[model samples]
Target chain A: MTASRENSSSFRNHTLTVLAIVLLFLFLWWADGSMAEDLGLSFLPEGLNGYEVQILNLVAVYGILAISLNIIYGFTGMFSLGHAGFMAIGAYVSALCVLTPDQKEMMWIIDEILPSLAALHTPFWFSVILGGLVATVFALLIGIPVLRLGGDYLGIATLGFSEIIRVLIVNATPITNGSLGIKGIPCHTDLFTSFIWLLVVVFCTVRLLSSNFGNVLKAVRDDEIAAQVMGINVFHTKLFSFCLGAFLAGVGGALLGNLLTTIDPKMFTFLLTYNILMIVVAGGLGSISGSIIGSVIITVLLEWLRVVEEPLNLGFVEIPGIPGMRMVVFSVCLLVIILYRREGIMGMREITWDGIAAFLSRFGRKKENRA
Target chain B: MSLELFLQHFFNALTLGSLYGLIAIGYTMVYGILRLINFAHGDILMLGAYFVFYGTTLFCLPWPVAVVVAILGSAGLGVLMDKIAYRPLRDAPRISALISAIAVSFFLESLAVVVFTGLPRPVHQPEWLVSIITIGGARLMPLTLLVPGVTAILVAALLYVVYHTKPGLAMQAISKDIETTRMLGVSVDKIIALAFAIGSALAAASGIMWALRYPQINPYMGVFPGFKAFIAAVFGGIGSIQGAVIGGLMLGFIEIMAVAFFPELSGYRDAFAFILLVVVLLVKPTGLFGEKQKEKI
Candidate 1:
């Protein structure tokens, strides 16, 4: 096809993709538990129960988070373990914003709510954006000093930062309610908003990666020395990637808090970061599609894995559920992946139709050869 | 604070700092040889504590015997962690090894939860160590002074081994240049394992002392000390043993002193270590005793 024709066709494809997503939202919204039951469409996949819907919300939140981490660690080659910290900032910011004064009054049992904070409130959208912006601000401050360090030093430093953030949140009783975390924050996130946020983040990330800036980021990741030799201003590029990732992570955290309708210091810890890292590494470090796909698999798997924590039965005997078995299994799986298959599911490759066709053709060829 | 109070805090700082220094050595030694953070080091320290917990309670072994057994078990575990988790990733990307270390850390933590249960159990503090002694109008347990003294002696013995032994020389040579040392007919893997063994033993010792001081044992107890010790290692210069100990002691003093000076900010005690680490890393990334590293083109 000619260049203009190709552009027009691509634009049409984009429109179709977006419209398809919108249709999905409309269907989901219309077919929610009550609606579907009334309409006699309760058995349909779209008529998800509360728990199933939660998994979807978690997928979207984690999809966004995994993408952010993928960009930082996969595309830009920065090993950051601060997503949990950023998410906590976002979660606290958004929760505090959306909560009414009465709710704040009820929740702050440890100390009286600050008068100014009690008065301050914002729409969910505005509050979420503010959370992202605030987290970005933190990332900017932290990145300026820390982006200079390389490898594990940067890793440890970022980990330290997240711990520090948690510590601050725990100690700053007036602001974060100290260890007695906020409760009963109004639920603001649903499938529609979360998916929209994920789409926007993924779209922006994809566009950014395809641009000149993305190339510079990959260059810096592959070899900082070579990128610097080519005059690519490595520090600024790294700082940009770090800040962007933090901003998205912050947004994800906000959505998570709203979805859970609760916020606490204990919730955002290394394990939270570890969950996102597992998704990122499992999906493929540098691929956006990989993150989404990985998010779906890992989220569903996490929910499914909860079965191990419940009582089990055999023909002859019953065994009590193991409390921490899920984490053990998850860690072992990750270890096997890291040890045996370091590239993960997608590696550096994206899921293209052409690639899919090629994979199928190879499968067909193998079948024919076997015959 | 009164003079007696100040002295008591000083002893507290010394004991805590020595324990931190002990754990920090594990991190520094591992980093010096592998250039890997051994994220599992803290978890290994946790395992060491758990081992002691079980040895005394499960087997009814004497405290000293249990301690020795726990240290040995930790050493074995450290070496096994290397052989299994890290060995295959020798040629892989450095981050792969790091992620594996992370996996092992959580695996041990969750495993502890599974085996030892998630609840925090009180450690068995021997009567001799728990006994109070008065010094300069400051009353403290015998364990306080014993902890630092024991740590000092272990560190000195470690220094002598690292400087005088053939295996220690091999470890130093490998850290400088793994390939060159390999070419020089050194058993690099064995030496690396040896380093892990020693580091893990020290971590276990630190864990035991920490348990005695706090009189509590839990799966997650190692996480904070592990982090602070790593910070200490970095502060002292990541690859330098002496630097790690000094860094550990300094960190302990800073944390205790800062809390003592401002009781209101005691809740932010953990933040002090992270902030100190960030500042030290920014000022001199190589740390106090670390040699300057030049980036190669």
Candidate 2:
């Protein structure tokens, strides 16, 4: 009887938690839409502008990227700097699929796009999936060979592959339109679509991490020889984590390209990979929810940090804006976090409902005493 | 390609490859001792170039004096980096050190951007270094010969120091086993710092030459050649100085010759090193002269 009672309460908590999240997402969706004024959200004064909405979308995209990286580097203990490459693959493939032949013709001013590729067109959702699948396939191909290497060697090898991939994209002018890049992509990515993808990614990754396979990944990470002794297929596990990370990274790239409506080969540089790595590290390497929170904070923090890049004035004095000052500050933050506070906010722990409730109750009691 | 064109390309390869070797030596020496890839080594090269640029233009120093000062400054910075960024994480997970290195790399690059400005500056090449000389109907920049000659002298001097000096033995011993070397009463930290100093100095030399070759200087310019040099180090053997030079020269040949022979594929020039890296990794994971993998147990 007590077991049943506990189950019911836990199920109720889960339902309440999910409902709360859904409601929050719905509010954001409505506020981001044009009809927000009609709903009498006068408190907001003005509904979110394009910049605000774009930041929100960026949060979702980065959330996906962080989680993907968390799986490859965090739980699996493989230091991969390949997110940019995988994302590039996903971005280009999805863009190609969704562009109409007319759009393709207009975009490929350098060289006419391949005749076979010109007619390709798929629904937005299908194209995103195709982007992810292509990335996954490419990941599989590289992962098979590279996974044999471990630690820093693997990182360097992956970085090399990512660079090679970018070079290929640049040279394949007939396909990727060379350096001109794809422009005027239909802006199919908004907060709702991107957040839904983020939810799906989080759900899947959380499930995978909790499964027996998750234990296997940890075992491999902690000690490869020990995992091998325990009859684990170490290579296969690393490959699976790598491919999953690549797939999500690809999807995130697809959304990012749509959100921006343009992508040049240069856009997918090592800096992008480093940014996601920073997010994963700052969010707490092994925490899923930490990635979400990290992405939100980082996405906002990046935009907020733009203030440092702008010219400053103190009534009597003025300081010219430093072009790369923000990145300097950003990299300094990452260095500090890695050195002094590597566990980050979550420290490999997940956010739980009871933990939240307990904090709230303690706060309420404190207020009562003060009164 | 005509014989003259071929000779010119060969000399170009020799110049580029030796510079790669010079830079790669720093990578190998540091990796040998610390088991860490100094991601900022490339940035150190950039700093080397900038320091020289400033020393000559901003400070009005002579070219040779500028080279010496730049090399010293970069070496000091490298040692400083080791003290501030990497030393604290000596006992932390290996990944922490690697991450710290990456962070330092980014920090230096971004810091360069902020301080130096993001614009690529034209490096004023000295007429003496860049003057073209025709020998037997083959015209070549003096640097095409000078870079290799300087690199050989420096490398030979380095090999002498590493192989013949007492501190050199300590460095080798440290690479073999840090704890054992410590037990033998060697100061590991001092040796490590020495390695960084030497590595940075050599990298500075390469950077100055690289600037001479390209005639342009920028904050972020060290990234590509740095990575390629790292690859050359790996190809030669991560811990072997001789291997790194040989590997670098081989890479330089492959890159220049491939472009020279196949003009159509010049666009893929950067891809060659990465491809070589992957191929080397698959075929000989330890590189040409890297030590065999030994399980600690």
What DockQ, on C-alphas, does every prediction get? 0.90, 0.83
- TM per candidate comes to 0.96, 0.97
Assign candidate 1 its CAPRI class: high
Evaluate candidate 2 and give its CAPRI docking class based on DockQ: high
Model 1 scores what on Cα lDDT? Answer: 0.91
Worst 10 residues of 2 chain A by lDDT: A38-47
User: Which segments of candidate 2 are over 4 A away from where they belong?
Assistant: A35-45, A358-371
Clashes of each: 0, 0
lDDT tens digits, residue span B242-282, model 2: 99899989999999999999999999999999889888888
Question: What is the DockQ score, from 0 to 1, of model 1?
Answer: 0.90
Residue-level lDDT for A303 in candidate 2 = 94
Q: A-chain TM-score per prediction?
A: 0.92, 0.94
Error of model 2, residue A57, in angstroms: 0.7
